[model samples]
Target: MSEKVTVLVAGSWGTALASVLADNGLQVTVWARSEEQVAEMNQQHTNTKYLPDAVLSTQITATSDLAAAMDGTKAVVIVAPSKAMRQVCSDLKPYYHPDMLCIHATKGFETKTLKRMSTVISEELGCLESDVVVLSGPSHAEEVVKRLPTTVVVASHNAKAAAAAQSLFMNEDYFRVYTNLDLVGVELAGALKNIIALGAGMVDGLGFGDNAKAALLTRGLAEMVRVGSEMGANPLTFSGLAGIGDLMVTASSQHSRNWRAGYMLGQGKSLDEVMASMNMVVEGIRTTEAARDISLKYNVQMPIAEQLYHVLFEQSDPRTAVETLMGRNPKNEMEVMKLETWQQWHS
Candidate 1:
C-alpha cells in the first residue's frame, strides 16, 4: 500500500501539489468542502475548475470528510489561502496527531494576526512551530501541474522534518526539493515578493518599460532584505530561490494573478473591478495589505510597498504612485540597503 498523504483544500496550488505527491507513489487524499468537486476528482480524475488543462493522477482521491482524509496519513500539506488558514487549521485540529509531518505551502500571512502560515498551523494543531515545514519557492501551480521543471524549498527548524518533506516531494525528473533551516526567511521572502509583483504589474499596466520593472524588482528585493533582516531572518535568504527567484517569476510571469490584477489596476480599473474579474484569490492583494502593517511595525522604509498600498487601498493613481517612487530623494544604490545581518557574514 502506498503511504497516505492528505492535502487540505482543493485550490489550484493544493491540487497541483497533490499531483506531485501522487506522482511520488503516495496515496494523495485531498479534502475539499465541495462534495460535487470531490466526486468529480474521484470519478473523473480531474479538477476542472482549478486545473482544467491538466489531468490528475489516478493515485489521487478527494473527499469532503476531514476525518477520513486525515486518517492514516503520514504527512499533511496545508495549501489553503492565507485568509482561511487559521480556520482551516482549527478544523483539522481534531484529526492532527503526532508523527504526521505537517507542511504548509501557503505563502501569505494572516492579515489580522500577522502570523506566518506555519505558526498558524502549529497553534491550531498544538505542535511546536518548528515542527511545521514551510514549502515555498519560485514554482507556480500553472507550471508545476504540467510537470514542468520546478524547484521549491522546504524549510523548518526541525532538520529531520525538513528532510522528510524534501524526500516526500522531490522528483528527479521534474520536481526538485531542497531543504533549508531558515524558516523565517523562507516564509517572509515568499510572502513579501507578492507586494513587489503587484508593483511590477502596475508598472506594466502603466506602460512602464523593462528598465522600470527590473528596477522595481531589484529595489523591492532590497526592501525585503531590510525588513526580513530586522525580523531576525538571514539577510542572505533573499538572495536565494525563495527570494529573487520567486520574485522574478511572480513579478514578470503572465500566469501570476497578482501581476494580472495589478495590470488591470494600472490600466485604470478599481480594486473592486479587478477582484470581480479575478475568479481566483490574488494572494498578492492580501499580502500587500499585510506588508503595509509589517513595514510600519518593523519601522522599515518600504517605499514601493507603501506606494502600492496607497494605490491599492487609498485609491492613489498608479501613474502617480510610479511618479512618487521615481521622485524619491536620491541615495547611494550600493550602500542603500544598510543591511547589518549579512554584513556580519563578511566580518
Candidate 2:
C-alpha cells in the first residue's frame, strides 16, 4: 500500500501531522504558501516560525506548488485555517483527483457562509460532503511533534474512507486514531469547543480559581451540546474524544491559541491588541461569532458563545460579560437535555 500523503499549509498542526506521517515511514509533502517557508522546511527540516524546538523528519519535504505537492499523493490532509479553506480548496481542485482520500483537520466555520471546513472542501472539490473525513480531537501540534501519546478521531459518513484515514496516521507508540461515524457531531464538537476554550482562558486570565474555570468548561460543554444537537449532531457524541476530550484540552492548554486570546482579553487587552500580538490564527474568536450566529439561526441558547461574541465584536467589557453570565436566571442543569418534553433522565 502506498503511504504517500500530502498535507496542505505549513502551520503548526499541519507540520505536526506531516511529521507523524513521516514517522510512520511514509513519504510526506507539506504545501506551504510561502516559498521561503517551503525552502526552510525542505532544506532545514525545521519550521522555526511554527515548531521552533522540534526537528522534522527527513522523509518529510515541502513545496509551494500545489500541483507538485498533490502529484502521486494517495491522501490529502488539509490543515489550512478556516478563513482560507475555500481558496486553498479551490487551488487544490485543479490538481485533485477522485481517487485521493480527502481529510481536513481545520477547526472552525467559514465566516461568510458559516459552513464547516469539510463543507467548504467538499464544495470546492465537487465531492459528496459526507465523503470528506474530519480529523479532530484534543491533540496539539507542539506535543504531537514530540511524539506524545495522543488519540484523535477521524469521522466520515463513508466507513471505508474513515477507516482509511484511521489507518493512515495511527501509530501505536505515540499517535492513535479512532473511527467515528458521526461526521456532523465530530466537526461541530471540534469547532464549537474553541468558543468554550476562549471562555476558559478568560476565566484564567481574570485570576479566577479552578472552580470558575471548571464551571465555564461545564457550562460551555452544555452550550456546545445545545447548538450541536440542534444542528443535526448526535448529543452522545459530546461525550466522545472529539467532544469533551477536545474541549478539555483546548480550554486548558497553553498551546491553544483561542485560550491564549481569551486570556489576553480577560487581562484587559483589547481584541485588536491581542490579535496583533499573536502570530498564529486564533480560531476561537471567529468560532465565537459563528456560534452566536448559529444559535440565532437554530434557536439554541449558547450564553458563553454569545457573551464572547459581544466581547470580541461589540467591545463589551469582559468583567461585565462575566457578571452577566453569573446573573442569568437560575435554571436546572439538565434543562438543555430536555427533548420536546420536560421528562427527567431518571424518569
Candidate 3:
C-alpha cells in the first residue's frame, strides 16, 4: 500500500503540493475548509478558484472533515495561509500524532506574535520546533502543477526529518527536493523575500525601468540577509535557493499575490481596494507589518520594509516611499560584502 499523506487546506499551493505527493505514489488527502470546494475536488478533480487550468491527479482525494483527512495518514503537510496557521494547527492537535512526519509549506509569519510558521505549528502540535521541516523555494504552484521542473528545499534542524521530507516530494523528471539544515534561515528567507517581491511589483506598476527593479531585488536581498542574520539565520542561506532564487521568482512572476497587491497599490489603488480585488491572501501586506515590528525589535535597518510599511498601513504615497529610499544617507555598496576583509585586516 502506498503511504498516506494529508495536506491541510486546498489553496493553490496546498493543492499543488498534494498533487506532487500523489504523483509520488502516495495516497494524498487534502483538507479544505469549504465543503463546496471539497466536493469540486473530489467530483471534478479541480480547484477552479485556485488552480484553475491544471487537472489534479487521480491519486489525490479531498475532505472537509479534518479527522477523516487525518485518518491513517503517515505525514501531515500544513500549507494553510499564515494568518490561519494557528487556528488550523490548533484544530489539528486532536488528530496529530508524534510519530507523523510534520512539514509546512506556508511562507509567512504569524502577525500577532511575529513567529515563523514552523514555530506556530510546533507550539500548536506540541512538537519540537526543530522537528518541523519547512518546504520553500522558487517553486510556484501554477508552474509546479504543470510539472515544469520545479525545485524546492526542505529545511529542518533534524537531518533525519529533512531527509524524510525530501524523500516524500522528490521526483526525477519535474519535481526536485534538496535538504538543508538551516531551518531558521530558510523560513526567514522565504517570508522576508515576499516583502521585496511586493516592492518589485510596485516598481513595475510605477512604470519603472529594469534598472529600478534590479536594484530593488539586490538591495532587498541585503535587507533580508541583515534581518535574517539578526534573527539567528545563517547569512549564507540568503544566497541559496530559499533566498535569492525564491526572491527572483516571486518578484518576477505573475502568480505572486504579494507582487500583484503591490502593483495595484503602485497604480494608485487603495490598500482596501487592492485587497478586496484579490481573491487570495497577499502574504506580504501582513508580512511587511511583521517585518517592521521585527526590525524595531532587532534594531536592524530595513529601509525598504519600513517604507513599505508606511505605504501599506500609514497611507504614505508609493512615489514618496521610493524617493525616501533614494534619498537615504549614502553608504558603501560593499558594507555587507567586505566584512571578511575587515576582519582579516584587523586580525
Give the candidate number with the greatest TM-score. Answer: 1
- Give one digit per residue, the lDDT tens place, for model 2 in 201-316: 99899998799899999998988887877777878888899999999999888899988998999999999999999999999888888888788888888888889999999999
Clashing residue pairs in candidate 3, if any?
Answer: none
Cα lDDT of model 1 by residue, 82-148, tens digit: 9999999999999999789999998898998888888888888999998889999998898999999
lDDT of each: 0.91, 0.91, 0.92
**In order, how many clashes per candidate?**
0, 0, 0
Provide the lowest-lDDT 10-residue window in model 3: 337-346
Task: Tell me the TM-score of model 3.
Answer: 0.97
Q: After superposition, how far is residue 344 of candidate 2 from its true place, in Å?
A: 15
Q: What value does the lDDT take at residue 9 in candidate 3?
A: 87
For model 3, the stretches where C-alpha displacement exceeds 4 angstroms are 337-347
Candidate 1, run of 10 with poorest lDDT:
334-343
Whose lDDT is greatest here?
A: 3
Query: Worst lDDT window (10 residues) for model 2?
Result: 338-347
Give the C-alpha miss distance for residue 298 in model 2, angstroms: 0.5
Give candidate 3's root-mean-square deviation (CA, Å).
2.2
